[model samples]
Target: MRIAFIADPLPSFKIHKDSTYAMMVEAAKRGHDLYFML
Candidate 1:
């Protein structure tokens, strides 16, 4: 499966500690593809 995360430019993507990052990592770990746009 594949997932895409589109976060707001200023506040949504806090880089290393953000939930979006976490979810992307988790998905990758489970063998899923992830795309992010900030």
Candidate 2:
């Protein structure tokens, strides 16, 4: 599946607390194609 995330800047995400980052990680584990947009 293809997943596009329209979110804040990538570098600004804190792995321990960012929900978007967590979702991205899960998507990656499932082998989805991910695109990040500012």
Candidate 3:
């Protein structure tokens, strides 16, 4: 499956407790394609 993640624009960001990042992690584990709409 193909998945796209959109995130807010910021100078710096943290991955901890980030749902989008967590989703990407799970998606990768499931072998899904990832695209960031940054």
**What lDDT score belongs to each candidate, Candidate 1 first?**
0.78, 0.96, 0.79
Worst 10 residues of 3 by lDDT: 8-17
Whose lDDT is greatest here? 2
| Clash totals for all candidate models | 0, 0, 0
The better candidate by lDDT, 1 or 3, is 3
- lDDT tens digits, residue span 1-38, model 3: 99987886534556786777778899999999988787
Can you write out model 2's per-residue Cα lDDT over 1-38, one digit (the tens) per residue? Answer: 99999999988888899999999999999999999999
Pick by lDDT: 1 or 2, better one: 2
lDDT of 1 by residue, 1-38 (tens): 97888887636567777887778778999999877676
lDDT of 1: 0.78
Tell me the alpha-carbon RMSD of every candidate. 3.1, 0.5, 2.1
For residue 27, give model 2's deviation from the true position in Å.
0.3
